[model samples]
Every structure is written in structure tokens, then in C-alpha cells.
Target: MNMATNTPLTDEQSTEAAIQRAGKTAPRVTLMDIEAVVTSEFYFTASDGVFGASNYRPISDRSGVALGLLTFCVLVLRNGFTVTGESACASPENFDAQIGCDIARKNAREKVWALEGYLLKQRLHVVE
Candidate 1:
């Protein structure tokens, strides 16, 4: 019995309805696809000495004691939305700026996935 109409639904009717629902286009996202959507990007850190391919930023005290390294990546999507990610290294010996930036950008990109997923779900709901 159909809950809404309280009518007896045959097996064929149920299968046909399920097949029809399955036919609706499903949305998907991939990391590579997300990456391509980024139009402009930049980075930030406490120190600029390692802003090269490694993208490392070092944080130190007034006494110039090496503390840690931090990397930040900001991604701006084609839609004008912005996302941010950060990477941190507690040991100065592990100074790798590029890795930090990559990590931060990845964190930021994760947010984009959530946002895009919600929008897609909303659109699908309307279609239903």
C-alpha cells in the first residue's frame, strides 16, 4: 500500500518507480575537479624566508628562537568564493613551506566540497 494514497501498489509499479528515481542524474565531485575550479590563490605565514617552492614560514620569538613553521593557502574559486587551509610544523628542522601551503589549501578545498554538495542537494530536491 502506498502511504500517501493508501492504494495497493503492485510489484511492477514499485519497481518502475524505483527505476525512474534511479534515472535522475546524480551529482559527484572529485579533488581534481575541485582543484580546477580555483581561479586565484595565495599564501601567508609568519616568516617569508621560505616562500619558495617549499612555502615554509617560520615563527620565532623576539629573542629569535626558532619555534615552528606554518603555511597557509587561500584559494579563490571561479565563483568568487574563498577557502583557506593551514599546515603547521612544531619542529623548525622540518621546515617545508610548500607542504604547509598544500595542507592549508587542501583544508580549504574540503570546505568547497561541502558547499558544493549542499548546493547540488538543494537543486536535486527541487527537481524531485
Candidate 2:
């Protein structure tokens, strides 16, 4: 009778082995851990779009381009997963380009925070 040949590895063991193969020491990670590794940033314009529009690129005085309404996008990526946040912002009465960029980036981060919260809840539910 060969127990090793007859027995199958448990789910936890399998998962841990996979993680080890991936070079990660831990088999499981909490939501906070995911959030810590998760990153979010804004892009001011897109390459193939208008001359100077979108979040991946913005028109500026340096380029002799008139400053106009700017659209920005927040891209969040983690462990092969991606999420996006988008915003259109303008230089207001007192706000400058830097300020507008800050606001846009903040908005995107909020979106990512909400998504992370939802994911955390789902993971917690499954564990219980």
C-alpha cells in the first residue's frame, strides 16, 4: 500500500506550491497586502489620438500649443489585473496645471480605493 501514490494534495498545499514556484513566499495575501502592492497613476494623453489630448499627453505652452481642457486617466495595475479611472479637468480661476493634475490623480486614486474595497469584501466572504 503506497499512501503517497494514492493521496492527493489538499487545495492549500497546491496553492502554496504554486506560490513558491512564482517566487512568492506566502500562499495567501490579505486585501491590505494587495493594496500595498497595487499602484495607481494618471496619464494625460493618448498616443494615437489628437495632437495633444487625452491623459497620456497634454498640450502645453512649451510646445507652442494652447492650454485647453485636459482629460486624464488613472491606471491601476496589480498582479496581471487592471482598473481605470478617468477625469476631465481644466485650469480654474485659481488652479493651475499642477493643481488640476493633483485633483485628477486624487480622483483616480479614490476610484481604485473603491474597487479594492469591493475586492476585499469578496475575498473575505469566500474565506468565511
Candidate 3:
């Protein structure tokens, strides 16, 4: 996890520290931290689309798309109004599944942003 050196809200850090002390395990990973990594990578790669060479295969009704790689399976849903992402992996011993889901959702949201821009221009008759 490429986490930032600066801590987040004091309350979050306190809670995480408490959880770690109680469990005697590695520092807990928060969803916010995971999203930060995903967003960072999204811009780091200059938005060449998320998940390199990963393609989206539409499911029935074209409401969702599935991406399968190695031991991971990610599902992204875009229904013209909302977007959602979820992932599952063969191994339950790690955080790959959750990270995959986060990346997938970020990828779908970028696509939606592009669509929104296009629609805006269409409505306003703005040239590209």
C-alpha cells in the first residue's frame, strides 16, 4: 500500500491505531486510503484508461461489464444514471479483491466524466 506519510483526520488515525493495537496485526487499511491510491495511479498514468490492457465485457442488458484477470474478477456497472464496481478473487487471504473493485469503480467514473463532457458540449453546441 503506497500510503501517504501525512496522517488523515486525527480521529481516523486514532481509530486505526486502536484497531491495530487490539488485533496485534498490521495497520488497518481504510477505504479512503485505498481510494487515494487508486486516484493517484489514475492521474499518474495520465488517464490512459484504468487497468492497463484490461477490457470490459458487457453483461446481459449492457448494464454491467466484467473483467477477469489472473485470480481476480471485477464487475463494473454503468446504468446511465449510476456507477458501481465490485470484485472477487480466488484468495481470501489478501486485499486484492477490494483494491480491484476500487480501481474498477474509478475507471468507470472516468468514462462517465468523459460522457458528461460530451453531452455538455452537445447541448451547448461547443466544438471540440
Give TM per candidate: 0.62, 0.47, 0.30
Regions of candidate 1 where Cα sits further than 4 Å from its true position: 1-25, 48-68
Lowest summed lDDT across 10 adjacent residues in model 2 is found at: 62-71
Best by lDDT: 1
Q: What is the C-alpha lDDT of each candidate?
A: 0.70, 0.54, 0.42
lDDT score for residue 84 of model 1: 81
Give the count of colliding residue pairs in each prediction. Answer: 7, 10, 0
Best by TM-score: 1
As for model 2, its CA RMSD to the true structure in angstroms is 14.9
TM-score ranking of the models: 1, 2, 3
**Per-residue alpha-carbon lDDT of model 1 for 1-128, expressed as tens digits?**
79999999755457556766788444655455676789999987645534353565443553222323666778899899888877777776776878878778778877887877787788889999
Per-residue lDDT for 23-86 in model 2, tens only?
A: 9853344334545755765565332245445434444553323233444655566654555444
RMSD of 1: 13.9
Error of 3 at 76 (Å): 8.5
Angstrom error at residue 47, model 2: 11
lDDT of 3 at 85: 36
